[model samples]
Target: MSKSEALGAVREVRLSGGTIRYRERGDGPPVVFVHGVLVNGDIWRNVVPVVADAGFRCITPDWPLGGHEVPVPEADLTPPGVAGMIGDFLERLDLRDVTLVANDTGGALTQIFVASQPERVSQVVLTPSDCFDRFFPPMFAYLSAIGRMPGAIWLLAQTIRVRALHRLPNVLGFAAKHGVPAEVVKSYAASLQRNRAIRADLGRFLRGVDKRHTLAAANKLAAFDRPVLLAWAEEDKLFPMELPRRLAAILPDATIETVGDSYTFVPEDQPRWLAERVVEFVRKHATT
Candidate 1:
C-alpha cells in the first residue's frame, strides 16, 4: 500500500514524552508491533493486513527510534527513554491484554517495557533482534561508534540518500536476505534527511544502547509466566540464530519458531509466514 493509503488509517495520540502515530486494523484482540531503528511502522505493512484478516487487531506505531513524523527532544530519546514512550503509548490508548510484537532494536525496547511495566501486555512475539551482548550486532556495531561522533549521523543521512548506498551491507543490507525495495529504504532515510531532530534522536539512541538493558530484562523475563513466541529469521546475517533457542530457555513459557527464507526483517521477506504464525499464536493465547 502507498503512504497515502497508510495515512488514511493512521491515528495519533500524545504520551509522556511526545506523540506516536499508529495504524490500527481489525477489531479483535490487540497485537502491537514495534520496529527497530531507522524504519517506522511501515515495516509491518505486509504482515499486518494478513493477520488483521485473521480476526485480530494490529497496531503498528511509528516509534521515536527513527522514522517518526515528529521527533521528541533529546530529553526523551535514550533507549530506555523511548521504551518508556512505548509504555506510555500503551497506557494512553488504554489497551490491555496486548500481544507485544517486536523486531530488531524494538525487541530490546519491548523487553525494557515489559520488565518495567507489563500490566498491559499479555503475551510477546519477539522476532530477530539485538540480544544479550550483541546490542548492535558486529556488522552494525560501527553505528553505535559513529553515533558518538559529532557529525557522523548527518553524514550517514547524506550517504544513504543515494539509492545504491541504501542497500549496502552497512545500511539495510543485513536486514533481509534479498534486497529491500529502494522506495521502502527511501522512506526510512527520508526521516533522517529532512528532520535533524530525528537524526539527533537516532544518534543518541545508538550511543546510549547498552546490553545491560536486555541483560537486566533477561532475569525479569524468567518471572513472566505468560506465553512468549521467539520467531527468528533463519537467513539473518547479523542476529545470531542461536539466541532464539537461548531466549526460549530463559523465558518461563517461550517457544521457538524459525522463519525460513528471510533475515532480520522477516516481515519484508516472509510476511505471509509471519502473519500466519502471529494469528495462530494469538488465537491460542487470546484472553478475550
Candidate 2:
C-alpha cells in the first residue's frame, strides 16, 4: 500500500482494459464506491473514511468517467461498456457480498450492473442519480449534441477551462448545492485538460446517454432481490426526488431514505449522513 497523504493507502488494480487507482480503509464487509462524469474517486474523499471507520472496508475507484489519470485506450466507454468494466473490476477483486454505494452517474451505472450482474452486490445505496427520462437531463443535453460534432470533446474541454464555468447552474451547479472547492473543481477537469484521448473517452460516454439505458436497467430490476436503499436528496432539482420512489417501487426489496441539504452528490454535501446510512445498511445486512 502506498501512502496517500491524508487519506489511507492507495493501490492499483490492473484489469483487462487498464489500471484502476483506488483507496481503501478498514477491513470488513466491502463497500465499493463509484462516481459520475468529470470527477474521480476523490468525490468520495469525505465519505469513504467515515464509512471505513465504521468497520466496513471502503473501496473507492477512480473510474474512467473523465477525471482518471490514464484513459483506457481502445476501451469502449459507452454506458453499457462502463458497466461491464465495473463488473470486471468486481470479479477481479473477488469481493463478495459487496455494499455498492454510488452517487450521480455512478448510481445510474450501479442500476445497470445490479440488474445484469446481481451476485457481486449484497446491497446498494443510491443518492440522487439519473433515472429513466432524466438521463443527462435537459441541462446536459447540449453535451451529447456537441459530442456528436467534430472535435466535440476538445470543444467541451475548452469550455470547461473557464474556471468559473464550474459553478454555473448548468455545469456543476445541479450536482452540488454549495460552492465546490477550487481544488476539487480543478481535479474534476484535470484529466480532460492533460489528455485529449481521455476527453474523447468522456465524450463517448456522454454522447451515449439516453433514457433507454436506465429504462432497460429498470426493467431488469426485479431480478436483483437484494436490499437497496434509495437515499435521494430531497433538495435535488436536477434529478427529481420522485425518481428514487420509482426505483424503490420496482426493486423486490427496497426502501426510500430522504436526505436533506444535499443535491445529486450526497457524498459531497452530506458525507456523514451518507456514511451513517451505509453503516446502518451494512450492520443490518451483516455481509460478514
Candidate 3:
C-alpha cells in the first residue's frame, strides 16, 4: 500500500486556536511525530508505519510550519505559542505519557513543549534539530530576516520552485544527504506556494525564531528529568555533533546515539534506522 494508505484515513481535531489534520496508524502507547519548517508529517511517513506496526499509535499531524495544507491565522505562531499549541493538541486528544518524536525545527519547538509542559509527555526522541544558540544555525539564519520583510515569504514560496535552487545550502541541499524525491519536494512546497494564509503563518513563526526561546527552554530542561534520546545524524551539515553533545549535558536523563550516513533529515535519509531506534527507546523506557 502507499504511504498515505498505510497511514490510514486523514482525520481532523479542533484545538483552541484552529483545526489540525492528521494521520494515525496502529495502537498502543501514543507516538506523536513533529516535523520542521517547509515540511509536514510526510517527513515521518516512512518511519511512522514501522513504529506503528511494532505496537505504537503514531499520530503524524501537518503542523502549521509553512508546508501544512490548513492555515491557523488566529493561532499564535511564536515559539512558545507553537509549543503551547502542542500542549493543546495533547489535552484535546487526552493523550498521556506521549512519546514525542521531533526533527529539524520541530525539535526546537519540542524542546519548548517538553520544557514548559512536562506533565503529559513521558519521553522524547529528538532527531537532528535546532538547539542552544544555533536555533536557525548560521546558514539559514536569513530566514528570520526574510520573515520580517513584507513580501519576502511570497518570494521564497516562488523561489523554491526552481529545481536548481533545491541544492543550495540555504535550501534543501543540506536537508537530506542523498536528496529528496521530486514529488515529495513538490508536496512540501505546495501549501506555501499557493496558500497566502500559510505563508502568513510561516512568516509570523519565522519572525519569532529568536535564540532566546531555545535558550530559555534549555534552562528549564534540567527540571524535565524525562528520558530524552538525541538521535543525531553523524554527517549533518547544518547542526553539528556538538549540538547534541551540549543537549546531552544539559538534559538530566539524556543520551546520544549517532545515525550514520545521514544529514539533518534523518527521517528522509535513514528512516529504518531511526524507526528502530525510536521503537527500542520507547520500549526500553516504557512507563507505567
Candidate 4:
C-alpha cells in the first residue's frame, strides 16, 4: 500500500490533558512513533508504512510539543508531567506490550515515561535524541531562554515562514540532512504559528525542559531491564554517538546500531533503514 493509504485515517482519544490526534495502520504488535518539538507524526510518514506492512500496528501521534492541532490548556506541561501524559495515553488506549519509537525531544520524554511506567511497554527503539545533560543540546538551548520571554514564542513561530530559514542550524538544518519537504515543514509549523493556545502549550513545555528530568530517568534506567534498541545516526550533529553509548552502558539490555548517511532525523533521511531495523529488533525480541 502507498504511504497515505497505509496510514489510513486520523483518529482521536480523549485524555486528562484533552484530546490527542493520531494515526494507525496494520495489525499485530503495537509500535507507536513519538516526534520532537515543532513536528508531528508526519515526520514518520515514510517509516510508518514499512513498519506497519511488517505486520505490526503502527501508531503515530501528533504530540502536543508544538505541532499539534489540539491544545491541552489545563494539562501539566512539565518534563515529568508530559511523561505522565505519555503514560496516560498508553493506558487510555489500553495498549500493552507496546514498542515505543522516539526521536528528538520525544526520546527524552520516552526515557522518563519508561522509567516511571514500564508496566505496559515491552521494549523501545530510540533514535537520535536528548539524554543526560544534552537535553536541548547546545545549539537549541536558546529555546529555553526564548520560552522564558512573553512574546518570544510568537516571534519564533513567525520565523518558520521563511523557507530559507528552515536550513539554518537553529531551524531544521541539523535535524534532517537532506532538508525537510516544504509541505512537511508547513505541517510542523502551522499550529504553532497560527494558534495562540498551541503556542501557549509549546511555551509551557519548552520552559519546563531541564536536564534534571533526563538525569533522574537515567538513574532509574538500570532497573528498566527491558530490551532497548538505540538506532543512532552516525553523522548526527545534534545528538552524537556518545549519548547513545552512555545509554548503552546504563540500560542492562541495550544495543546500538549506527545509521549511516543521516543526521538526527533518521526517519526523514533513512526511513527504510530505520523501518528495517525496527522490524528486526521487534521481531528478535518478540515475547511468546
Cα deviation at 27, candidate 1, in Å, is 1.1
Q: Candidate 2: which stretches are off by over 4 Å?
A: 1-7
Which regions of candidate 4 are displaced past 4 Å?
Answer: 1-6
Off by over 4 Å in 1: 1-8
What are the per-residue Cα lDDT tens digits for candidate 1 across 1-288?
A: 124243228788877776677888887888999999888877887888888877778888888776777777734777778888888888899899999889999998888788778888999999998877778788888888878999888888888878776567777777877767777777777878878888887887888888887888777877787888988887788887788877888888898899788889987888888888888888887744
- Candidate 3: residue 209 lDDT (0-100): 96
TM-score of candidate 2 to 2 decimals: 0.94
lDDT of 1 at 100: 88
Q: Model 3, residue 48: what's the lDDT?
A: 88
lDDT of 4 by residue, 71-168 (tens): 99988999898888889999999999999999999999999999989999999999999999998899999999988999999999899999989999
Per-residue lDDT of 1-288 in model 3, one digit per residue for the tens? 112565656888999888888888999999999999888877888898899999999998888888788889999999889999999999999999999999999999999999889999999999999988988989999999999999999999999889888888789889898788877887888888998999999999999999999999999998989999999998999999999999998999998999889999999999999999999999999842
| TM-score of each model, in listed order | 0.95, 0.94, 0.97, 0.97
For all candidates, what are the clash counts? 0, 0, 0, 0
The ten-residue window of minimal lDDT in model 4 covers: 1-10
Task: Please report, in order, the local distance difference test score of every candidate based on alpha carbons.
Answer: 0.81, 0.82, 0.90, 0.91
